[model samples]
Target chain A: MRIRCPLCGDRDSREFTCMGHETYMHRPAGEGWGPAWDSYLHLRDNPAGVTRDLWYHGAGCTAWLLVERDTTTHDILRVELASDAKRGNA
Target chain B: MVKLVEKTPAEGLLPLEINGISLTELVPAAITSLMPFDGQEAAASALLSSLLGMECPHPNRSTGRDGARAVWVGRGQIFVVGKAVDASVARHAALTDQSDAWAVFSLQGHGVEDVLARLTPLDLNRAVFKRGHAARSLLGHMSAVILRTGENTFEIMVFRSMARTAVHELETAMRAVAARDALR
Candidate 1:
């Protein structure tokens, strides 16, 4: 599998380290929130097929990547930098 | 700060020749100095880019705990490569050569991977190993970091004592491959 970086071009999948899903939770502003914490820590989907994941290019630029990958085959399908994805490049 | 030991051939390998450079240990401290820049990943990228004169195409970041970064120096300990500039030295976060350590062995030939696969579990497919991708894994029951220095060459780093074991395993594997190829 290969990952294409906006600045560095495409590189082998081994150069990237999988950091899991990109979904994150915002902290509650005030008051009791027991369930929120529990859900944040434990309730995460463990899908088997094409999944979106957070990967880091620890050998290149330290860019955070959101990649679509086939978990069963470890084949990466699409990759976008976190900075670009946040800018709505979807 | 850790003391640096320059390993000699006789102390580690049998009938050692002046062929490879080995460090006494993986001594994490040697590369720690390169971690203090504002964006450590950028700094690492720049260092390799400037040194190698090629764009380093891997994502890099400081490991954060001890100003370490997970560099692809091949297999094991997630090689933390760092450098220190004058300004950052005062922070007690800089890594001098004393802080980080490495042992470089130059292994070249047609079947280098065939020999390496015997000691490491990594999938060394050109499509997989490529260049600039390093992994932390075991080599012959010892911790090691393997770096692909060239298309047909690799620089394997391990603790000082494991150096002998590593060389033995590598030579044995290489000879085995040669023998097998001869039969074929």
Candidate 2:
């Protein structure tokens, strides 16, 4: 697939890095350490279908992105910043 | 040929281009922008290692500044600036330059940090993302590389297809800040 960048113009997808599924779980600061640590380190929901993800332009300026794409066909629906999207909204 | 101004002052926007590339010469060094590794940290690191002909460690993070004057940014990411980048180095990497698929933009000015904060989740606090540090993070859904070129300027690299979208987002934020400043 052809990937695009804001500054460098259109480059091949190889120049970009794929950061899978943008979903993240922030550990509750007040909670006990064990559960939070486990969730932070080992828990991840690998689902199919359309999902949001993160990517980095390793060869470029190294920008991170939040991308919504189809896991089945690798079709990208949308891309944005993780911070721009409210937490848990993905 | 059109005459390109090396340094031109825009009312609300800072000149971010340096000889056409989104880079600038800076002192003390800083990480103006970043690209999030997400989950491909390992793969990226390995690729860099092969290209650099050195053991880049797992999930490499590069600092923008050289030794002593260096600072560290996020995990599993590297900062490219100064001698770190040769401009032509991209040709050496395994990745193909689909330059047509991406667009490059430069960011400068005192408010550059504030503009980045609106689009990114990573802390832009100088104490955290100080000079010589670089991180990999997301910016408004586009995969990008944010390089700190100076204290007030940054080099933002994004895909060409998303150039207009990213620029619009940046300009909108910048204009809002300028409007707020005007009120003050």
Candidate 3:
């Protein structure tokens, strides 16, 4: 698989390491051992359709990317810098 | 106490020639990593441009003459080579000395592109990755920054610790390409 990095252009999947879902980026704050924290740490939805996930470009630009891909067809729908996604700019 | 001496990353491992391809270690005067602060991109670029006497580099591009150049590393990042960066630019960006952190080599020959093709996946056709274009990609199993300095020359940089591995990989590729070309 090839991922087109927003900063480095297209690169092979060997350069990237998948880091689970995009929600893994958001951590619950002001927590003192609660279900919200537990779910955030352990819960994951294995949807078969479209899903957004985070990938680290460890070998190339080292930029974190939020990739929207379809699990059924393995088609990449969209890719943006994770920082831009976090800032709600992408 | 005993005194310690300074040695470059690829001090004795390079300056190798296999067939027509030659790999020579390049010890630039200085190498500084520059990253502009938010909202200071233009200011930082202007300062660096004036200092290097070249336009500020854009993403995936480098600018300047030999002995003084800037190679874009990634988004908002560049490495100033060959000259000591001016302190005046510090107000616009963060500068970190990387002269000792990387091993740089100049690979030149008629079939330089064929040697790199065995390592990186990026398209390196002359028309596409023309001179002054830069890219951070994999060279064998090691991460590397590759720049096209001339039609038949390329500058490749890898982590200082991977100097041996980088040289070994390049040598292997050079010999393979040379042998293949001889057959043709």
**Top-TM-score candidate index:** 3
Off by over 4 Å in 3: B1-3
Candidate 1 per-residue lDDT, tens place, B85-162, comes to: 333332422343423244445566666788788777656776766655455445777655566645765556666555
Using TM-score as the yardstick, the better of models 2 and 3 is 3
Which lDDT tens digits does candidate 2 get at residues B1-184? Answer: 9997543112123333422223222221222212324555445445444544332322213332232111122333333322232233333322222323334455767767877887765566776655434444456776665645467756565554666567667776677666667797
DockQ of each: 0.07, 0.04, 0.71
Give per-residue CA lDDT, model 2, range A3-77, as digits (tens).
444433344566578866554524346756787677766777777888776777665445576677777888777
Give each model's whole-structure lDDT. 0.54, 0.50, 0.90
**Candidate 3, B-chain TM:** 0.96
What TM-score, computed on C-alpha atoms, does each candidate reach? 0.50, 0.41, 0.95
Q: DockQ winner between 1 and 2, please give it.
A: 1
lDDT of 3 by residue, B1-184 (tens): 9999899898788799998899999999999999999999898888877777865688789999789989998767889988989888889999999988999999999989999999999889999999999998899999899999999999999999999999999999999998988898
Q: Stretches of candidate 1 above 4 Å error?
A: A1-20, A24-32, A46-49, A54-66, A70-75, A80-90, B1-10, B14-33, B39-100, B109-113, B117-153, B159-165
True contacts kept of 2: 0.00
Rank order (by TM-score, best first): 3, 1, 2
